[model samples]
Target: MSSATAPHRVSDAPSLVVSLENSPEAAAAARDVAGDFLKGLGPPPGRDASDAVVLIVSELVTNAVRHSRTRACTLSLAAGPGTVTVSVADASPRPPCERNPDVRGAGGGFGWPMVRRLAVSTSVETSSQGKTVSAVVAREGGPSV
Candidate 1:
């Protein structure tokens, strides 16, 4: 997947804005971007929080690539005093739904539910063009449930 990370202003806190191609690889790319962005923040968001952010990024991007039916998507990450916000925008107007996890692990569904468990808050905005899913995670880390 083609990806580009825009330059961020360090003075305002670490942030990342990236465009991703609608492909399976985009999920991994999103994780990589999150890693680099978090790394650039110096002290890091703690191991647990960092991992959760990356996982959230991967799930959101994967859901967009797998279900959005769009040719491209954008991911934005911003870290504040004690929280991080991850947002993914795709070309599909439909919002995401949480399905019962597949017991066989065939990958039919699972991402959204995990996101909800990990994130402090989650929201979706839809329009004629597409939809944007945003999740906020506490940088201090907490129980996934």
Candidate 2:
């Protein structure tokens, strides 16, 4: 039972936190944790919001694993009425950049933009030790494609 496999659920708050190793597998693990939390939210927000939130979680965790210079990272999810806030924290203060997309899709400059487009709001907080990227996604309709 490691941090990666067992996520920490906050009893006082509508949120969940998961510790992750900075590897490709981090994204999958994050999605699982996010899905579990979303499933408990009930009918109001419905499936679309949950799917979008999970995707956002996947993208953020993937970015941290791929770009951050750390052994591990943390994924946090906080749910609101019709929205969820997804945050990924790693031991790097550098914020993510939105790169030019590769039309041929050989290179990946897509995830960041897609994240921006999907979230109701997005932000990055940096500290001397690390940085956290957060996004708010709505349960119903979100950003325009």
Candidate 3:
């Protein structure tokens, strides 16, 4: 289950928020929420950008649920002038690590790499209680460099 709330928006739109307890369905739920949110943006983010946002949402939420040694996490999305920022805050201090992809087996470690390549900007903020991972992706109609 997820709960959502937005910070007060003065000149801009409110951020999209979703709270998810660690569960197998968390990733899918996040993707759906992201897709829906993108549709509300004035001009569509374009096929590639829209797809990237959903994929990023899935990868990040999945990581929080599968790796974070915590019971819940929050997924927040904010749309800026030309970019969409997706952030997942989990109750864990450890940051995400990348490992070589498992081609033949199921020791899956591909999520982090895909996320890095898709987001033009990425950040991780760690605290005593947890960490928040954020990825910023540019919209197609906006600046690419």
Candidate 4:
């Protein structure tokens, strides 16, 4: 008898990693991935945190597209016991800076601050070829509120 192909059964919550091109499309794609990741979490303990995650994804991806020379980016989502970690890697050695208000007043930078405000933990690491900006958000308790 021929063996029947078993139907694929996926878990309700699963980690996702997506590589993106350094273009405008990457920002939108990252946001979509964030939304899907939160939905896969089966119900965010707090809705605001979920929204923040999406916005953070967009801002990070935009920065990657704008600054990176390699024109390649990656978005990764991992759910832990109480937090979800979102990491964006791009081919850029120059790290992001939190420009002062006077500099921002020139109307150029603010993304980093927004990211810092939304995430429980934010970090940037530089590698020989590029950098990775990672943010961890508390999915359970939700943004210290």
Candidate 5:
């Protein structure tokens, strides 16, 4: 690939970033922000999509609290032309992992799967200081206003 033929990327997404204390109350607050962000999306006519966004918020926040030992975490929301992105960052150096289910198991190990189903794309990135889990979901055919 040459410079002249390189792909172009747009950098116009609107974003909100928040640093939250690592506590159960903070987690609940993060979910509320995420839910509000989703509700504030241009398409306001459908309640179902907003509900799905709330579900995503719950899973992501829960995972951060359960697996991380960070004193604080950051929640970021970015809105694009057709999609919304949610990212949660924690100070834990450990990457998020999924648990293998046992046939006899009836609980646990279901958060990641539920996130995958709700979001169009989900990813985890780790740095020397911490980790960030990001998920993107499309808001297609939603409210026009």
Candidate 6:
């Protein structure tokens, strides 16, 4: 887990960026990072919002590692007044697709769909070198769980 949080700038809110190897642990690391980042905020996002962010981060990072040929990926998180933006960049230019979920719960495609459901907005950008999948989640004012 190689990560860095951007220095607080007078004009912008704080942000976090992490570089992760294409391994099983990357998703967990990303979740922890997101949790910590949210907690550090002056007024942290609600429990629902925080959980949604972690779940979305895990899904995006997992997709990048499992589907792409890339050896590593980068995760970026930025929080504003009422929303947080999560972005994962990988070396593959192919866009993500939601696959049919497996009923047995052994292992099937479900990440993409869950992300869409939790996020207020989601987008993907692709170039010759790679692609970045981004999702924005609205922060609620409820108490943390």
* Best-fitting candidate, scored by lDDT: 1
Which residue runs does candidate 6 get wrong by more than 4 Å? 1-13, 141-145
Can you tell me which runs of candidate 2 are displaced by over 4 Å?
Answer: 1-13
lDDT string for model 5 (1-145, tens) is 3333221222222667776666667656766676666666676414555655566766777777777976767777787777777788888978667787444767578778777777778898999988889877766522232
* Predictions in order: lDDT: 0.83, 0.82, 0.82, 0.76, 0.68, 0.82
Expressed as tens digits, the lDDT of each residue in 92-112 for candidate 3 is 999999898899878888988
Expressed as tens digits, the lDDT of each residue in 1-145 for candidate 4 is: 1112111122335577777777667787678767877887765646877887888888888888887766578787778867788888887889888876456366557888888988898999999978899988888644684
Q: Root-mean-square deviation of each candidate, in angstroms? A: 3.3, 2.5, 3.9, 7.8, 11.2, 4.7
TM-score of each: 0.87, 0.87, 0.87, 0.82, 0.76, 0.85
Q: Give a tens-digit lDDT track for model 6, residues 39-71.
A: 888788888898899889988988987999788
Candidate 5: residue pairs that collide: 43-143
TM-score, structure 5 vs. true: 0.76
Residue 30: error of model 4 in Å? 1.0
> lDDT tens digits, residues 1-145, model 2?
4455455554433777778887667788888888878777755455677778889999998899888968888898887877788999999999999889999979898999988888989999999989999999887757541
Error of 4 at 26 (Å): 1.0
Model 4: C-alpha RMSD to truth? 7.8
Q: In terms of lDDT, which candidate is stronger, 2 or 5?
A: 2
How far off is residue 85 in model 5, in Å? 0.5
Instruction: Point out the higher-scoring one by TM-score: 2 or 6.
Output: 2
What is the alpha-carbon lDDT for the whole of candidate 1? 0.83
Candidate 5 lowest-lDDT run of ten: 4-13
